[model samples]
Target: MIILGVDPGLTRCGVGVIEAGAHRRLSFVHVDVVRSSPDMSQDLRLLAIYNGLAAKIDRFAPDTVSIERVFAQENRNTVLGTAQAAGMAMLAAAQRGIPVALHTPTESKLAITGNGHALKPQMERMVARILGLNEPPTPADAADALAIAICHALRPAGALQGGEREQHLTPAQRQWAQAAQRSSGRGRRNADRGM
Candidate 1:
């Protein structure tokens, strides 16, 4: 399975694509950071994110998308942009009839590093080790994206057997599932329109 993972942010959204084999081993396909200038208007910035993610989706043709769930932060503005970028990711996946999974920060960290509170350096190290990269991916965000993908790829079977009926999902994950359903039709329509 090919999985695309996104660490969404208006200024520096991170994207990573990985392919998993029958033996559960993973290989890196691509890693990138999509940047939008702070000086750009909100709509323009969001457009950049949407277009960039859409292109990645088309290029990678991932089987599924794994995205980091947005959490409340002290900075409301930051949180809002992150949520918006995340929405763009979902839209890109849904447009292609791809399923989306949302993983919490702690969940991703634990999946990769065996520690919920692992630091950035530790997480990066594990990501490199798991992918057998000579060095960790740069800019932290990229590494985080890769980690999110690995988390979903390595998730226990019990969690994914029920489709969207999986239990213990966070509110953000449930919301993503619903949006993906709604967007599935929209995706076809958009494709018809050459969007």
Candidate 2:
């Protein structure tokens, strides 16, 4: 299965493509950070990002697209831009009829480094080690994209299919799944309380 992972941003979007082979082996096919100038108009910037991601989807023909889920941030501008970029990624995948999955940064970090709070350098190192690269992918965004791809690639098939997947997950995956559940529960509780 070919998977395209996107780390979306208005200024710099990271794209990584990997192939999942038999026995869960992964081979990195491409990694790049697409850049847009801030000086450009917002609509133009978004267009640029969308075009860049769409081009990758067309070139790679991935069976699925994995993207970083945008989370709340203190900077509203940053959050808005990120959300917009993420929307572009979703649009590109949907236009091509490719399955799209969103993974949180914590989930990706835990899956890649066994720590939900892993630092940038740590994530870079683990991603490099997993891909058997001589060094980490550069500019943090590229590494993050690869990590997101790895997280989705390593996930059990049943997990995505809504069956008894827990029985097949590795120990680390179980932990990640449990944490995700707990996090979602908290969000629900907060929503119920009108927070």
Candidate 3:
């Protein structure tokens, strides 16, 4: 399947297109930035990003579109803007009837680095190795956007499909899951020690 991953931002959104097979050895088509002007109004910048992304989507004609889930931060404005940018990209894919998948940053980090809290540089290194690129993609944002795509690819297929939807887990859910994992690990350790 061909997947176009978007890292949506007003100043410079990053995009990466990858294709994979049933066993899913991924292939990279392109990874680059969509630049916008500094002096432009927010609306115009968004429009430019939308149009540029639409053009790339047209050019790639990917089978699926992957994007980062809208994340909440202390800065409401930042979250809203990222959500808006992501919304525009989703709309572009919706116009094509392509499936859209949202992945969390943690999921992306885990998929690429075996750790849920991987640094940007670590993610870039994994992306570079996964695609066998001579070097990592630039401007961290683009690498991050590509990470979003890679994250979706690593999801359990049944959970990803079959009418299931992604929930942008809250901090509480994350904490609970981590605590559960710790509990499970302790159980395993106890069993091993007894054995």
Candidate with more favorable, higher lDDT: 1 or 3 = 1
Clashes of 1: 0
Ranking by lDDT: 1, 2, 3
Q: Taking the tens digit of each residue's C-alpha lDDT, what string does model 1 give over 1-195? A: 898999999999999989999888998889999989999999999999999999999999988799888866536769889989999998888777788888778888888888899999999999998888989987666988999999998886665523334223566886776578567744223222211
- Candidate 2 per-residue C-alpha lDDT over 1-195 given as tens digits, one digit per residue, 9 for 90 to 100: 998999889999999988989988888889999878999999999999999999999999998898887867536768889889999998998787677787778878878888889999888988888888888877666888998899898864544522123323666886776678677664223322210
TM-score of 2: 0.80
| Per-residue alpha-carbon lDDT of candidate 3 for residues 1-195, written as tens digits (9 for 90 to 100) | 778888877677889888776776776778888877868988987898889889999999987788876655525656666777788898888787776776667778888899988887888999988877889977666887777777777776554421113223345764665577577664223222211
Question: Which residue pairs does candidate 1 place in steric collision?
Answer: none
Error of 3 at 188 (Å): 33
By summed lDDT, the worst window of 10 consecutive residues in model 3 runs over 186-195
The numbered model that scores best in lDDT is: 1
Per-prediction TM-score: 0.81, 0.80, 0.78
Best candidate, TM-score: 1
Task: Give the runs in model 2 whose Cα sits over 4 Å from its true position.
Answer: 156-195
